[model samples]
Target chain A: MRQINGQPVTTTNSQTRERILEAAEAVFGDNGYHDAIVDAIGRRTSLSKGGLYFHFPSKERLFFAVLDRLADRLVSKAEEAAAGDGPALDRAEQALRAVLTALSRKRRLARLLMVQGYSMGNQFERKRAEIFDRFAAVIEGRLREAVLNGEMVEADPALTARIWLGAVNELVIHWLHAGGPSPAQRADEVAVVLMGGVRAPMPVPMPAELAR
Target chain B: MRQINGQPVTTTNSQTRERILEAAEAVFGDNGYHDAIVDAIGRRTSLSKGGLYFHFPSKERLFFAVLDRLADRLVSKAEEAAAGDGPALDRAEQALRAVLTALSRKRRLARLLMVQGYSMGNQFERKRAEIFDRFAAVIEGRLREAVLNGEMVEADPALTARIWLGAVNELVIHWLHAGGPSPAQRADEVAVVLMGGVRAPMPVPMPAELAR
Candidate 1:
């Protein structure tokens, strides 16, 4: 029933809500869940405590909202890459690269999601797993396609997807711990390692050895 | 210096301490650190609060001691497997199998270490990283030997080690999530995937004359 310029009041309220979430991501990313306070997040925005609370009922709610926004962005990027036309492995690699790129740009937020998010409580822990499951499903889908096309060997796509997800998560954790480098480059290396493996072929036995 | 059954008081105390840690592992593993109480662990044994406190100054201390014991057992098993005479990949697989076997038998404890422990606080987080580092180092050392002996392709041993550690950790996490099947068998499949990779060989082109 309210209007400002050409926009309705709900639009204005939604815009404000988005800004609050943006600030929440940075505050939660920087201070972690335990240390992050609502006041700190409010300071970064133009809204009052009442306005912020109107958008998010509590700090825990705000934290989960930020995580949800992050998860949505990441999952969409990966989905786009996976749905693109290319070799199955290449497309999967691109999806992974897209994920790393997005996370690197939001490195602090990435740390908050990977390290601090799960430990908050059982609810948050399950939420984190669900987010990870989305990523794993994308990878598993691509892996299944690769196998059907004969671009990959027969293997459990679900298990392989989980393994790949874990490897990528670990790499990101280490990268964050060491401070962010060019994660795009590291993503390429990870693709190679995961697709090709690390072992060298054993030398063939000599004729004399074979006789023995 | 009271004696028990002709044993020195110190020896009896040490035995009691070990018993307390064993019970602590199950309690923390089942309840996690926050929900886990000193009294619960005490009830699992014959120790009272006073007796438990005598052996472990605090619940956190008891929790760390249990983690340390778990770490020691895992590291020793990996070390023995790595030191055995065999191709490097085989040794690494054996080491991984040993880890999976140990973890499968103590599923609750493994969850405690991998999931709940890191989020407890900075101290536990740091301790978890240190334990992971030890495993990575052993893996790195074996990888170096493999490369030198031509059993593995040349690559960054340190990075590969970390990646391997991450993959194994992820697999265990998934196994726990899926409610612990025989992880030993899964470990073999993981080894094959890690060592040989998932990419299939490219098909050779047919001759032009044959096509005609």
Candidate 2:
């Protein structure tokens, strides 16, 4: 095992890192990036300042770590759902629902990742865009499959995927703002609205004679 | 004519104010709230620091003035389109297109309002939300009229409006990022996708079966 400060590194070190991350998530989510401090995060964990600094050198690095962990979890859930056996659109819907469920469970993390993270600086903005692109790529792959399987209309998968992602983003932001519907309910609504659109039902064509 | 600092203020005074605002928009849009300074704005406007200060007292006030002007312009254009003599959905589409047109023309202002303004802290966030609410209110009014006129399915106008606004916001942001299609073209695509949805068309029922 690696030695640090004359103590052999063990699983406890990893656990301490995890605890610090969780505490950082809560603090950053609550106070935002500017007001968040390492000491506050350390207070929440069993670690002292030295232990916390051992894991994360600075507040910026700690914030990014929290965001990275959150993004990984979200992406993993989405990927799992997307990989399930089903119609492509159904899988896509499932993936979105999975992501939204995870987000609802971690609302603070969601705010930090989606809201505050974007405003930090150019570097953070690029990270945010890259994460969105990851989601879009996943969605695009599913959409391509849907088009091939005749489960959806043929369109530019890339553009359609991006538009879909945008809709989902907006829906999540709105859910955060209003706070009424459950993630599952909102997911259903979003899937329906995005898939079917809000247009009135088209009238069925009458028989030729009736039309004449 | 009003005189300040032993000089006569004429229509030139109004022109000077407009000049100051235009310069301020570019400055704030490019550098953001904190980095943007009144001196830079004065340099752009051919005005002395005293001249700029005469028109706007502080950076906060100047920033809000730019935002308020942009918001007013957008809201007015949207209102004009929404109040047109057309079906509610069509009017809504038109309103969205109008806003997009204005946004495309004033991309810097758009960035300032949508991206930077949201992160400037609680005051600007509230202002951004209020502006979004104004747009949503217009959309909701149109949606309510559509439901009454049998042009749309009955739904929560408020919620639907907010969702639609979110969709538009995402589309615009994506446009800013991707930079290919014209705003009008993108607006058309958005309207079609949003109103019609991405689902495959349902099979039309047979008339003979219906007659039976």
Candidate 3:
């Protein structure tokens, strides 16, 4: 079949590597890491197993390439979001919403990254950890800005990022796996909790005798 | 081998089932769900493949049994924590801490659950949803009490519970895989963000600085 651009796409070196990575993402998302076969990924594109091997040394490397691509998109999105001007809290929220929404859109890729992402062993795991820390740093920077502006109480930025990331991540998994609710609805609900917490004060009822 | 309590553990239907479940937990934890085999679990005790099959019927069922056992422990812990007498927020915090800590303790079990807990097809996924809602209900009850006592803001209990659960679950996964900081330290950090959010107020200048 012809490539999306309608031109004859090269299946050599870098181009082959990119196609293999894309195929790996789809295959991994569908069958998970353990169940996914490198052969299948190669079959998805024009590349033979030998051709794919020329780019990725093994299945693990191909999987990491897929994860790396996804992480790059996330990092780029975060950078763009950070550069925008707004209240720190609002900006953080916008960044999170954008990332979460994007993850939701790429439901399969997101699941592969979050759920099966760590199964790739030390090398891939370390790379994933770096990406995770980078994402956390973005949040931490915005959080520090919020602190300087008196928008929130004192706390560690790293810890705050973990909480926010954890909250959004778990909610996304639920939205994807369970057929109960829409991602948008779940994201909004979680946003409320992240922002206000469950610690809002309750109203006190007035006595009847106090009525004038 | 003889029973631990001279109860003929493998002689009865229920006891034999329990033994198989326990063995499965150990095997799954040690080898991960996908790698764990039926024979490995059976070898842990005086049960043959046929005998184990009589109880569990299949490896999948045995895996489910381990999941059910963990869910029961978690449910009981949540109940005890929620029922504990204390200030509303204090109780809530205590309950959250207890559940998160328990999850961390069962790190291998948590790993198995994450990889296969929701992958058990529609029927098992339904059961997973039920267990999830049950845990969420415990959190919702605590939140309701907090609202009543003016310890927390009035909010949608169900929604809040989902968010809190999501955050805790992700934290549990990170704690399990990374083996970095203590779970308590992580939990404390999450508590701060959940309560106060990512933003912290700016520090005010001293009176001496104002004079200057």
Q: Candidates' DockQ values?
A: 0.25, 0.32, 0.22
lDDT by residue (A64-90, candidate 1, tens digit) is 889888889899999998887787866
TM score of chain A per candidate:
0.82, 0.81, 0.82
User: Model 2 chain B, poorest ten-residue lDDT window?
Assistant: B195-204
* Better structure of 2 and 3 per lDDT: 2
Candidate 1 wrongly placed segments (more than 4 Å): A1-11, A35-53, A57-59, A179-183, A198-212, B1-11, B45-51, B180-182, B198-212
* Model 3 C-alpha lDDT per residue in residues B1-212, reported as the tens digit of each score: 55657785446668777877888888776665565677888799667898788777677777777887888888889888878678666677777788887777766666655444433333344556667778888888887887787666556666667777777766665566567875656777677667542122225455445544
For model 2, residues A38-103, the per-residue Cα lDDT tens digits are: 788888875689978888888778888888888888888889999977888778777777877887
Tens-digit per-residue lDDT, A137-192, candidate 3: 88878888877877765666666677777766666666667655655556665666
lDDT score for candidate 2 against the true structure: 0.72
Interface RMSD of each: 7.1, 4.0, 8.8
Count of clashes in candidate 1: 0
- What's the candidate order when arranged by decreasing TM-score? 1, 2, 3
Clashing pairs in 3: A147-B200, A152-B199, A152-B200, A199-B153, A200-B152, A200-B153, A201-B153
* CAPRI class assigned to model 2: acceptable
Worst 10 residues of 2 chain A by lDDT: A195-204
Which is the better candidate, 1 or 3, if ranked by lDDT?
1
**On residues B1-212, what C-alpha lDDT tens digit does candidate 2 reach at each position?**
76668887565767887888899999888766655778999899877898788888887888898888888988999999888678886787677778778877866767777666544443455566778888888888888887687676545566567667766676666666667875556665666666665223545566766665
